[model samples]
Target: MKLLLIPDKFDGSLTSESFANAFVAGMKKSGVPFTSRYIKATDGGEGFLKVVGKYKPCISIEVISENPLRKPIRSYYLYNKEDNSAYIELAHASGLELLQYDELNPMLTTTYGTGIKINDAVEKGVKHIYIGLGTSATNDGGIGIANALGYIFLNDKGEVLPPIGSSLRLIKSIDDSHVSEKVKQVKFYTVHNVINPLFGKDGAAYVYAKYKGANDKVISDLNKGLIRLNKVVSDKYNVHYNDVPGAGAAGGAAFGLKSFLNAEFLGTIDFILKLSGLREILHKESFDYIITGEGKIDKQYLNSSLLQSVIGLGMEYGIPVIAICELLEISKEDLKEIGVFDVFDLKDEQKNLEYNMKDTAHLITAKTAEYFSDK
Candidate 1:
């Protein structure tokens, strides 16, 4: 049998590449007569650049930037000299992974570092830029980026306001006279992993701020700020930020880029798949089974275009798709309805969190061996 192993990162434990390696090792140990191919699947989040860099010939450039807390750090991006294009993963500079558990407050975090990365690419005279927006640690609605690009946000007193989430509601006007001319010359594309809107109950602050360490009060404040910022964007740029799909991604970074940088949004998985030629590979190669999973498997995965597209491809090719996830919240019937042949949940009754973390790879390998050995 020929099997394709494609999985997303297991959050804090393993990367997609690592997960694929573990799965391959298990398949080898199973003693099953099978040839396996591996591919890293990402939703334009943390591992986007690593997966893209695997197939694309690009130069890595490191630059100085700040983290969510405005601390100086070194970050990098991939540049394709042949196409005069740059690929940026937002998480590299302004990601939640850069922070500790105690420092995870979105109200204080900023995307200024992301802007610094973009400015670095722009200064290098790149003609096109593609940015992956995921795994962010801020809820500033792109104010920090705008600030870095020379757009000054002011309060009612006409004094410059700090570019942070809490300052969104204090912006009385925006000054664009000092905005970078180089930024206008480049075409920007934002790869969005989610489809949330800019404001309202399902919007940026309401749905995502909690993950960034917002309390009930902070969430409420952030929501109000998002609403006010939407109006400001409409008045200043004549763009209705709330009308755009995926505007809430990365805590309104999508909205901020669209309104200020004239960015066009694209689905993360589709863009990555196209860039990696995965669809063409699927069409050309014949495989009996396709395996995929992530840190968690829930109804939310069903809403993801990434998972949906994979399922569609499997159904079209008549290949059975199996999932092995750290957590499984969907039922067998639901899984079948979504074209998943089976699911393997990693949480064992006998294992605790610490044990699971330490033995995730081994457990996955052993389980895969046992399951296919029976087959």
Candidate 2:
């Protein structure tokens, strides 16, 4: 059988690259006489550039920037000189991964580093820029980025306010007189992994701030701040992005960019697949099965364009699609109705979280061996 293996990062246990390697190693050890092709999948998260850079020609540009906590760090972006286009991952500068557990306070973190990266790219004369927004450590509503790009936030007393989540409530006016000239010439595109809006019950603060270490009071404050910022943005720009789909992505980075930078948003999987030419590959090659998975199989995965696209491709080609995850939260019948042929979970009766985390590669290999052995 010919199988296509395309999996996202398994969260804390394995990256996409490591998971593919382990799965392939297990197949080899099992002596399974099958052909396989591997491709890494990313929904604009940590491994975005690694996967996109695999298929696109890009020049790496490194710059000194700040982390979520405003600490100086070296970050990079990929630029294609031929098209004068650049790709920037928000996580590179202000990702939650850049901070320690104790430092992960959303109200204190900022996206200033990401803004600095954007400023660097714009100054390089790139005509078009694509930003990947995911796995961030801030909920500043993009004010931090605006601050980096010379958009000043002022209090009612006309004093500058720090570009942090807590300062959103104190902003009296946004000053754009010092905004970068380079920003006007470029077209910006934002790729989003989720479809949540910028404000309300399903908004940025309510939906994501807790994960960034927000307490009940902080969550309430952040939500109010988001509401205030949304109104201010609409009053100034005459455009309301608060209710737009995907506006809540990356802690309102999408909403901020859309409101201030004229950014267009695209679905993460659709854009990446097009960039990687996955459709062309599927049309040209014949495979019996497609295997894809992430760290967990939950309701959220059901809404992911990545999984949906994989299932669509499998159905179109009359091939079966299987998912192998560390944990399975959905019922088999539900998964089957969505076009997944089967799910192989690492956490069966004989395994637990600790065992799976400790020996992920071995477990995956053993499971692959058993599955094909039965077949």
Candidate 3:
């Protein structure tokens, strides 16, 4: 039997590479005669630059950028000299991981730090800039980034507002007089795996703010701020950002880039699949089964469309696809109807989440071996 494995990180538990290794070990333990190949791929999230570096001849350009609270931190982006292209992962500058438990308030957070990285790349005369948007720590509608690129947000009194989530609702006007002329010449793309809208129940603020430490009132306020931002953006760009898909990505960073910088949106999975030469691989090889998974197989994962794409690939090749997630909350029937041949979860239900996470590698190995032992 031949298999191909492609998995995402199990959140805090295991990386995709480690997960694949453990699974392969399990297969070996089962004494199954199998040949397998694994890929370390990312959907333009944390490991995006690493994937880019694998495909492109690039160098890391380090720059001092700001954290979510406008504090200085060292960050870097992948710069390709051959095509003058740059790739940036947003979390490198303004991610939830950068904050302490007490510092997890989205109201005070800003994406200005990410903007600083973008500005650094822009200043280097890069013709193309691709930003991977995920795991952001703010809900400021990305005005913070605009601020860093010379766009100014002002209150009704014409006073400049600070670049924070709290400032989004108070803005009455935007100024681009001091914006760089070079900004208009560059091509920009916001890469993400979600298809959420700019502002509403499914939008950035309502769906993501709670994880960023927002209370109900704060979430509502942030949602209102996003609406206000959309209005302002629509007025200036003659584009209705709220109607756009994927505009809610990274706390409206996608919307901001499209509205402010004329950036296009690229789905993360498709972008990576093409760049990683997955199609080329498929043409040269055939696998009996394709194994793919993430940390959770819940509603969010259902909406992610990553698995769906993988399943589509399997269906195209008449190969069965199997999922091995940490927890599978969705109906097995639902997944099966959509081309998944099987689903296996790794959670040790007898134990608490802490133990399960701490020993995920073991659980994954045990489950894989047990499933194939009798086959």
Provide the global lDDT of candidate 1 against the true structure: 0.85
* TM value for model 2: 0.91
Tell me the tens digit of each residue's lDDT in model 3 across 216-295: 99999999999999888788778887768888888888888888998888876567667778778889999988988788
User: Candidate 1: misplaced stretches above 4 Å?
Assistant: 29-31, 300-309, 312-319
Clashes of 3: 0
> To one decimal, what is the Cα RMSD in angstroms of model 3 from the true structure?
1.7
What CA root-mean-square deviation does each model show from the true structure?
Answer: 2.2, 2.3, 1.7
RMSD of 2: 2.3
Ranking by TM-score: 3, 1, 2
Please write out the lDDT profile of model 1 over residues 185-290, one tens digit for every residue.
Answer: 9999998667788878878888878989999999999989988888887998788867587898889998999999989987765675678787788789899898
Q: Which segments of model 2 are wrong by more than 4 Å?
A: 25-33, 300-305, 312-319
Per-candidate local distance difference test = 0.85, 0.85, 0.86
lDDT of 2 by residue, 80-110 (tens): 8878899999999989899999899988999
In candidate 3, list every pair of residues with a backbone clash.
none
> Clash pairs of candidate 2?
none
